[model samples]
Target: MARAILLRQLTLGPRSRLQLERKLRDRNVPMEVAAALLDRFEDVGLVDDAEFARMWVRGRGEAKSLGRSALRRELNEKGITGDLAEEALEELTPDAEEESARRLLARRVRPFDRTDPAARDKELRRLVGLLARKGHSPGSAFRLAAQVIDADSGDNVLEQRPY
Candidate 1:
């Protein structure tokens, strides 16, 4: 029965071992039964935390434009931890993160012209908040926001300031 439940869950989507175990516990499956079933699943490659972490990181990073810190928090929430989580996060380079941040800012700030100080400042604050919530450092967010604004305006008018 435990095996059936686990297989049914996996048929829907991949699940971390911890998630699977929690599901089994929620269903009142005995601890020993859950352990044995999970061990079997692991042996058969049906429950692989590392691979789950990797896929999670890739999918979330691309879909959400999240940085390493955000990715780490997500993995932790999914019960991925320690070296496995770190290994998955390694797939996203700092350059890639920076580029994603720039793209996000560009798309969001396109409406506000950089020539207008009031509008630009308001837009910058909003963009920086977006980036910060996505786990980007304030400094990097400010620098990238300024770069995008300057490039769009065709003038290096926006100076990089500490956020």
Candidate 2:
């Protein structure tokens, strides 16, 4: 019974043990049975939260251009915890976010015109909002968009302030 439930859930996608446990309990599976089944699944390599977290972060981050901060939040919400999440996040560092952002900008930067105030305002807001939804901070998203805009236009729309 426990295996049936677990397999059903996994057929949808990988799930952390905690998330599975919650769902199993909600379905009225015995706690002891659920725990034993989870242990068995782990011992046999059928369930691995660490691997799940890693793959989840990589796929979502790359596809959606999410930053580390956003990815971490997603991992936590999905029932991944502690060192597993941290290590997976660390492994994703070293330009993954920048690469994702570059890919996103490459696909969507053509229509924005930095010279027109109203058009620039609308474009900047749209870009910032889109990037923010993907987990980039407002400041980081703005800076990255500015980089793309300047590179394409030969003039910096967001000139750096004197430090």
Candidate 3:
């Protein structure tokens, strides 16, 4: 029954060992039975934390444009931590993260109006808050927001045109 439960859960989606253990425990599977079954699954390559982490990071990062911090928090919640999580996060390099942040900000920020200090300050705060809510550091959020705003300062018509 436990094996069938594990297999069914795997069929639904990839899961970390800890996730499976929690499910088994909920279903009243003995701890020893759960451990033995998990061991067999791992040995047979049916359960791999590293691979699950990689897939989760890639899928979530691409789909949501999430930062490393957000991804790490999600992984940690799912019982993926330490080296496994870091290895997965490494796939999202600093350059890629910056680009993603810039793209997101570019799409969101309004054209700058230096003529109005109140409006400009409000927009800057909004952009920085956007990135912060998405799990970026305050410094990184400000930098990226500023970079995108500066890049779209309308000095160059062809380059700054938004699609």
CA lDDT, every prediction?
A: 0.83, 0.79, 0.85
Highest-TM-score candidate: 1
Residue pairs in candidate 3 whose N, alpha carbon or C atoms collide under 3 angstroms: none
For candidate 3, write residues 6-95 as lDDT tens digits.
999999999999999999999999999999999999999999999999999888876677889999999999899999999999998876
2 versus 3: better lDDT goes to = 3
| TM-scores vs. true structure, each candidate | 0.88, 0.83, 0.85
Candidate 3 TM-score versus the reference? 0.85
**Across residues 50-154, which tens digit of lDDT does each residue of candidate 2 receive?**
999999888988878788888999999988878999988887764667667766865677565567888877776777777888778788789777666666453
Give the clashing pairs for model 1: none
lDDT of 1 at 71: 93
State the TM-score for model 2: 0.83
TM-score of 1: 0.88
Cα lDDT tens digits, model 1, 1-163, are 9999999999999899989999999999999999988998999999999999999988888778898889999899889999999999999888778867766765676566556899878877887888999988889888777676666352332223222
Per candidate, the number of residue pairs that clash is 0, 0, 0
| Candidate 2 residue runs with Cα over 4 Å from true position | 110-113, 153-163
- Candidate 3 at 126: error in angstroms? 1.3
